[model samples]
Target chain A: MKILVGIKRVVDYNVRVRVLPDGSGVDIDGVKMSINPFDEIALEEALRIKEAGKAAEVIVISCGTDECQQQLRTALAMGADRAIQVKTGSALQPLSTAQALLRVIEREQPGLVILGKQAIDDDNSQTGQMLAALWNRPQATFASKLVFEGEKLTVTREVDAGLETIEVDLPAVVTVDLRLNEPRFVKLPDIMKAKRKPLDVIPLEELGASLASNLDITRYAAPPLRQKGIRVENAAQLVQELKNRGLL
Target chain B: MSKILIVAEHDGHTLNLSTAKCVSCAKAIGGDIDIAVLGQGHDAVGAQAAALAGVSRVLMISAAHLAHPLAANWAPEVLQLAANYTHVIGPSTTMGKDLMPRVAALVGVNQFSDVMEVLSPLSFRRPIYAGNAIIDVKAAEGQKIVMTVRTASWPATGSGGNAVVEQRTAQGTAAGHSRYLALNSAGSERPDLQGASKVVSGGRALGSAEGFALIYRLADKLGAGVGASRAAVDAGYVPSDMQVGQTGKIIAPDLYLAFGISGAIQHITGIKDSRTIVAVNKDAEAPIFEIADIGLVGDLFTVIPEIEALLG
Candidate 1:
């Protein structure tokens, strides 16, 4: 009856990212920020469930700096009843994010958890499963379709060859894929109403969880530029070059 | 003393191409390759994994309950299996995307997903900026190294004769947050886009979803899987499942035939590994021609029909 959705703040996909000159990180200046694209799908799925009367309550939760409150409000404006923000100045890896979400899970005890399959920034699609493991729950990741029947949840997953569907008991984690549904836009009236809704801000340390990264990023460097190609005059010359490169 | 764990992601019986590719990556990393198969009647899956070249053992976690892969359930077993293995690897499929990071978290490490090249046992290369740029990263901590392979670039191991299977128990987790309902397979005999050696893709320049469907016709003739650039997918010309790019699915088919696609860096990164790349773009200066083995400076509507007629 209780549904929880995980949202993340990421650099807007439209912006062209530039690597820092020092090769330490991406340049964050003047870049537009928004909720992760896939997370939007996750929030939309939860909203639909609530609209269908399948969920008694829907809560949007996010872990980021104070800036992430904007993303939480976006979710709430779309239809989430309330929002929970786990504030942290530093960026947390998927592992630490999962740990923090587990602390929230313990408190909220939601029967269903939905999250984006992967965040476009780090692209590490691990948090949902990690939280599921820590909570001893069953998880259906990358769901194209999800339906609840009795105490069972049926989920269709996108696999390499094709699609696959499975049913697991309730209290499971499901990650949303892009095809799940088109998220509804927040009208002006809903946005104004969401402003009046309750939004709670909690510090990560207050949750008694360590946001330390278990893995060290010793160094990050851009990949070498691809080799320049020889100018060709015709198909014959292309064939000659292919032969030279041993591609033929 | 550290064993290499290769996670098998399949429907249940047949082995997927990415599994074989991961085995090849595992061999390059140098370890006693062990397979972990989860599903009902994993006997065939275990045998298939064991038969692959360089596999030493196959760990079968057969359970009626595991007929489907639940990352929540699977991660805990991997955590337990980590006690026996030194390293773990899988293909960068949606399932791996969901499962690998959890295993890494359970073992208390940050997992590197969608790695394209293994520079060393500890160093790796992955695409960032939506595959517009590559980033080399080094994992300096954690006793176990966990990462997912980018599929097409890695060579798959040849079929082997037999393998040893050891059945293990699944950790029953009470938190059933999600469940498997039903499957609607794409139902194509052609190889999957991610694992195919030859890929034929279409773009929005073809004009409509029906135009994109031509890819299937060509792919069927060429015995290749259908692929599409993000432009085609985002334009609603094709299903998101058919997208081939950094934000979509990355592939390295042997022969890539791209029709009507201008080579965006993200789109190019997906097919850059193809041994022979042919691009048919009306725009002669399209970036795709930069890396293409064959460039047809003509309209795809004109060139594709000609190519299809030639093949016929």
Candidate 2:
């Protein structure tokens, strides 16, 4: 069995992303870019499944420009057997990205596909589910725990109401949540080895993936800012303030 | 003029407040709104949905597999009904975030999340980067707009009107491969964190699971929903259902009180929409103070008691 892990190159989670003053989009000028935090969790889970002998090979794939190969190398360093980079502009949305991955899925035919529930950048938690819809396969999303028994796979999903469990068959998509596992830190030795690993770059158009850019973003602006507040001296002052505001 | 179909969320008994919030968004878009309640034996839920002010009608869709809110089964049913509506929308809750995209894909269109403001039927503004920035998006002309409403940013439509309720059988069947096991959740008597007007959340500083008793006591007194930072949930101090963060519940309450939370950006994303924020962290320089409407550099343990006494 093979596990294809889908990852994305996104703005580092720690960096406070700023909107471009020109209203084009976010400013990524000289900003640190890395594998999305959730994508790393997905990769880590795929690696563990392979380490546990449930799978044979772990192939990490990313959809973006050549610059994304840098993150692919990072995934390779983190223990992916190889990497595939679908060449495309950086403006790809979740639907198109899912289509590109499906193209790769046709080429790889992995038994299981794992992706982060959402990209921290776009915050669109749609790809995994969209991919399953396009592939006509079962999707177990927001998975925190995954247990595979031969052809059957059980997933524990984290939901707003509470935790729910569901079982999906193989050749399915599983979007992981936070509690799945903590990603391991890439070591210096692994970085050197990753440089020697195979990395393939394919143009998205060659794979016959359609770019669905239907949502036209017209402007970018900051969210409403809160007015500077006063500091209360003590619990008594806080209580009085709450009363004045009628929040009490 | 637009015809909007709302995919209602429910527990087979009562309508989730999020459905009413979607009604608010659809009303803003200036449309004839009909809610589709897909579940098993959901007549009560159908009646509740039909009473919302802007709802024109409620469609009760029933099948044995519709009892669980699984996207695989529900999306196909929604797709079948999508022909009559120009826009199909749902709440941006876990269920919505999970289900809407599948429907959008099946319909061969792009889906929008967190539709904060409706500029026109096809254009709207939504938040990105964890609420740090907003984007104005416009769907292509003549394309069906499939979206999820940012329930936090919208007020629930009042329940005043009485609309007709109709029953229909689901054309979609359950997936052969996917089956729901059992859900493991401890039912809480407290108000749901997402819909509560006032939210009181604790952080890792609560120290232990037993220490959350203090937070529960305070929330009980104030009649607020209880939430926790991801740290507290990760530490097992509370269940993930009580978590409030970028990955958890994005809540907008009239009054939000963060006790001992250091205000990581992830945690701040969940509460940035709050009307008024109050912070009680011992650390004076906690990042939460930057956005807090009231900041008190004191121990939450001691301050909570004093505030409780004052309320008494």
Candidate 3:
């Protein structure tokens, strides 16, 4: 069985994001970019599954501009056998993105597809579920733990109530949560070897998928600020302030 | 002139407060609002939803398959009910996050998640970079709008409505590909993290899994909920459910107490809406002290016990 992992390039999680002064969007000029943290976890899990001899190959796929190739190379270095870049300069909405992935899924016919539960940039945890719905297959989302049992995959999900375990048949989609696994670092030798691996670029239009954003982002702004308050001396002073404000 | 339909979140026994908070968001949009309660033996939950102010009607869908909230099983019923309404809304809780997108996909509409403000009937403001940046978005006209309200941003709707409750049968068969096996939930008698009026959070400074006992004990004394910073949760000091940070649960309590927390920006994002914040850390320069209303430069191990004793 082959495993397909969807990766996305986003601003590094550690970088403090700033909305542009023009109210267009967050400033990404000269800012560091990397594989979305959760997507990295998904790719890591796929590589582990392949390394365990449960899968034959792990294919990494990304949908973005030409610059996304940098992240795909990083995935290749991390241990993905091959990479597919869905070349698109425009920002694709979740549905359009899923539709494009569906076209690839039909052609690739991987036994399993793994994606990040949400992208930190958009914070929209919709792609995996949308892909599952469009594919007309079962989806196990927010998977914290996954175990393969022949054609069946058992996924433990992080739900609002707590952890819930579910079983889905093969040819299913699973969106990974943070606790799945810690991604491994890419060594220098692996980076050199990854440069020799196959990286194919497919244009978004070539996939014959309808790409349209149903939602239009009008403007961007920084969130309302919370003022820093005065520091008190000790617990006694803290209690006094709470009592003064009738919060105790 | 828009009619809204909200899917209620419940555990078959009690209605989750996030549903009322979603109703508050829907009310702000100025609409004829109705709620859909989907689960087996959910009459009590349906009644609870019907009682929330601003609800015009409640459609209670009693189905055995819905006993566990699975997206594939719930999406069909929601899509069927969504035909009559112009907007569909749900709480951005785990269940809603898992289920709403599927409903939107089936209805062929894009879902707006974590909606913090309703700018217009179709426009909304939502936090994008984990609450660091806010974006104003508008759904295209001539399409049904699907959205999930960020519960922390909206107040819970009051209980004064007298809406009628209607019973409805499940429309489609359960998607048989996936099956619910089990749920290992952390059973706690303390108030829920999101609904708690006061929260006491611990950080990595509390070294081990056994170290969380101090936080729990202090929370019990104050009648507050126990929370943990992402560092503490990652260090295996507590369950992931107790984590309060950008990637964890966002909470807006009346008072927030931090013990040995350095207050990373990700963690502070969750508590920015909190009314009052108090930090107790040995390091005087910890970032948590920056936003703290009262900062105590002391060890949590020594300060917590003293505060507990004083309260007693």
* Cα lDDT listed for each candidate: 0.78, 0.91, 0.90
lDDT of 1 by residue, A77-153 (tens): 99999999998887887777888888898899898999998887776677887777666677787788987788888
Native-to-model Cα distance after best TM-score fit, residue A100 in candidate 2, in Å:
1.2
* TM-score of every candidate: 0.88, 0.99, 0.98
TM-score between candidate 1 and the true structure: 0.88
Per-chain TM-score (chain B), model 1: 0.92
| Model 1, residue B171: C-alpha shift (Å) | 6.9
lDDT tens digits, residues B1-312, model 2?
Answer: 899999999888889999999999999999799999999888999989989997788988989888888888888899999999999999999899989999999998889998999999999998888888899999988899999999888999999979889998888788787888888876888888988989999999999999999999999999999999999999999999899989999999999999999999999989988999999999999999999999999999899999899889
- State residue B41's C-alpha deviation in candidate 3, in Å: 1.5
DockQ-based class of model 3:
medium
- Runs of candidate 3 exceeding 4 Å displacement: none
TM-score of chain B of each: 0.92, 0.98, 0.97
- Candidate 1: DockQ? 0.38
lDDT of 3 by residue, A61-114 (tens): 999999999999999999999999999988888888898899999989999999
Per-prediction tally of clashes: 17, 0, 0
Q: If both were scored by DockQ, which would come out higher, candidate 1 or candidate 2?
A: 2
User: Model 3, B1-312: lDDT tens per residue?
Assistant: 989999999988899999999998998888899999999987899889888988999999988888888898898899999999999999998899999999988888778999999999989999998888999999877679998899889999999998999998889888888888998889899999999999999999999889889999999998999999989989999888888877788888999999989999989988888888989999988988878877889988988887887776
